[model samples]
Target: MVKMGVEEGEVMQHSMLTKSIERAQRKVEENNFGIRKRLLEYDDVMNSQRTVIYSKRKNALFGERLDVDLNNMIFDVAEEIVAEAKEQGNFEDFQIEVIRIFAITPEITAEEFAQGKIEGLTDRLFEQAINAYHHKIDAIGALTVPVLNNVYAERGQIVENVVIPFTDGIRGIQVSANLKKAIETNGKEVFKSFEKGIVLALIDEAWKEHLREMDDLKQSVQNAVYEQKDPIIIYKMEAFNLFKSMLAAMNKDVVSFIFKGEIPGQETTSLQARQVNQAPVKTIETKAELVSPTGVSEEDVNDGPKEPVRNENTVGRNDECPCGSGKKYKN
Candidate 1:
């Protein structure tokens, strides 16, 4: 029984020692993991710092060169501005516009340029950009003018439009205005001409009708003056004035219608309408005075005479001059 007890106690002590060894080994493993993690972290920081230093150095060295390259490509400036990004390694912004400026400087650099898969046009455009900076603009612009009026006209005339451009301080200023843009008379020009014709005809017709109406009125006044041959010459002068105005209004297109206002030795029938329409004129008229008038009856006629008036002044011309005065020149 004592020997058995001794073996059991020894087993317990051995087991405790094994557990302590395992715990120490676990602590060592945890410390190793921490050291490895810190080393990896340090390596990551060094790599990041190396990348930043390299980028900043690259930009500082080629920074001005990149700008020069862009200026040579775009012909925009002698000392152009080139952009740089902090995150994307080196020469990224410089490379962007460089592909447009010159052929890939593959021979100049030990490494192949990145843009090997872009289109051919992109390369050509970039090359042209660089080439443009090398030379002056000598390109001649082109224009086309369509022939108007059957490509030619025997006697037709044409006018042209002009363009003016301002070139105070620009690198290139082109006066690009059509000298004489050809517009066919069969086109909108013809339509505009036709429109003007229609408007003129309308004006002419309006004035024509108006004048003819006025002419008719003047002729009537002239006839009235002729019938009043026994009246004062002032009325005939008025009739002449009306007739003159009739001719003026009738021929306004050919004449200016400027009134000299001088009736002259021979009177004019111009003032008849104005004067006739203005005042009143009186004449001796009775039923007996117009009954036998058949030579020409201007006014409406009556067929029969009603009667005549008898007066005590029915004396001879030598007797008081038939004016009812008791005196005569020979009495």
Candidate 2:
């Protein structure tokens, strides 16, 4: 499903839908350039057919003629098929071409095809080819429908996993998730997330203030459960389960969701429900120093590769007797 966003004031910017339309427009324009290039190739083929037709007309004996004459007329008609068909097809004779490709699949086993059939076959050889094709095609046709039906049956099982039937007993809370970053860019890392479980009717300071109060209550309720000094097993149900029921009753808009199979540990529910978010320890770069207790400038520290020192006293070319060669430096 698609939705649009609107604002009463301030910045008048493009919504998600508007951005999608712009992107689709750019794709259409890009595809049109390629489509025009392909049409030029088709036009060249049609012109060649017309040249052949004119060539055939030059010869007088053309009435329902056999061999070459009949071949030329067939090519001419094939070149002039409808534009709808051109768009619907991958190629000019897509259906015929697809059938011809698959026709080889059942006929002449893969091993025999690898052995390679010779070219320029005789009329008797063509009759043998016709019999071979019919035999293979009949075998495939008999089994294909049942095979296709089983494929659809498997597809139906897949569809059931995603779709759970809605009933009167089931209450739906339509929590809005901004999947724009994920869907628009089609990125795996981009996510649909919330600040907390708290939903805002309209995200404003007033709504945020209410959320803070509710968070305070939620924490207090958890703390009270611990103070009672009861068994942890029974206390958890009262602390978490009943609180969730009250939260669900508070609004018809906050969705209760859990990521797949992530049951809460006996010790901890969800760590994300904590009051404050901490930047991970990995975020700190130990090599680079920050402002320290001492008033020292960071720019004073050098952070670059050291240069290699040149070797000294390795050779004195002019006075060398190491090899006793006449060509002193050349050696």
Candidate 3:
């Protein structure tokens, strides 16, 4: 070893313990660096996923072509339906699925489906599904636009932007759109906001869950080293799988919510109005009226005869009688 303060050409001898300690220190540093490098590689995987998710969220939040996105999703779902049915060679199942998802019966008959090519079937179903969805929106607009106009006329206010309520049974979100645009598009413009809200909500929820899963995965993958496997490689592969599964689930949920979601319609509004108009109004009781002359509230007094309380230590069915009968309690 060469001492820092030694002159040129001078060498200092160190004990064996000192050399061993220096080697251990260097080894510890290398181990730490390796750990850090592994961590960086893991984070790189997450960074890529984060970038993808945030990009989607941004598009949903501010993009102008959300209808195009929705159309693509609709087509993808339609394609999936057709492909599954084709794989199973079941036209009945295909028709059922189309009705279930799109609320429209397929125009193609069983024979036509049996003879149609996969690409042709997919395209045909996509066209039908998209058209049905548009018609459904137009029908809703037919109901909603009149109601909106009525309200605006009564209020004597100009219509600009309007907030529409959409629900997926469990979750409800309010989406805003330009009334003029919605009217021009026959309620398709309002659905753009619907798609935007649904996409954003699903993305946020799925991304949060994905993060938690990734955290668990990170901790769990640490044990891979004990199995004589490279932890980083396992983590990367598993993380990619997890990400793909997450994306698939998110997309499915978005499509399902969009198709199955309920918008408040004229019938619902009228039913609510009738219910409100017919509901009986009850008068609130005053505190003095609630109290009896005995200074106790009528509700506090039970009018019925009280039942006797049973003792907790009552004889069990198998216990000997307390009357000295030397028989079981049941007997």
Best model number under TM-score: 3
- Per-residue alpha-carbon lDDT of model 1 for 265-313, expressed as tens digits? 1211211111111122322233334445475443455546657887664
Ranking by TM-score: 3, 1, 2
Model 1 lDDT at residue 179 = 27
Clash count (model 2, backbone only): 0
Local distance difference test scores for all models: 0.34, 0.33, 0.76
- Best-fitting candidate, scored by lDDT: 3
Error of 1 at 123 (Å): 30
Which rank order by lDDT, best down to worst? 3, 1, 2
Tell me the lDDT of model 1 at 52.
36
After superposition, which runs of candidate 3 have C-alpha atoms over 4 Å from their true positions? 1-18, 154-161, 168-171, 178-186, 266-331
Instruction: Output the worst ten-in-a-row residue range by lDDT, candidate 3.
Output: 271-280
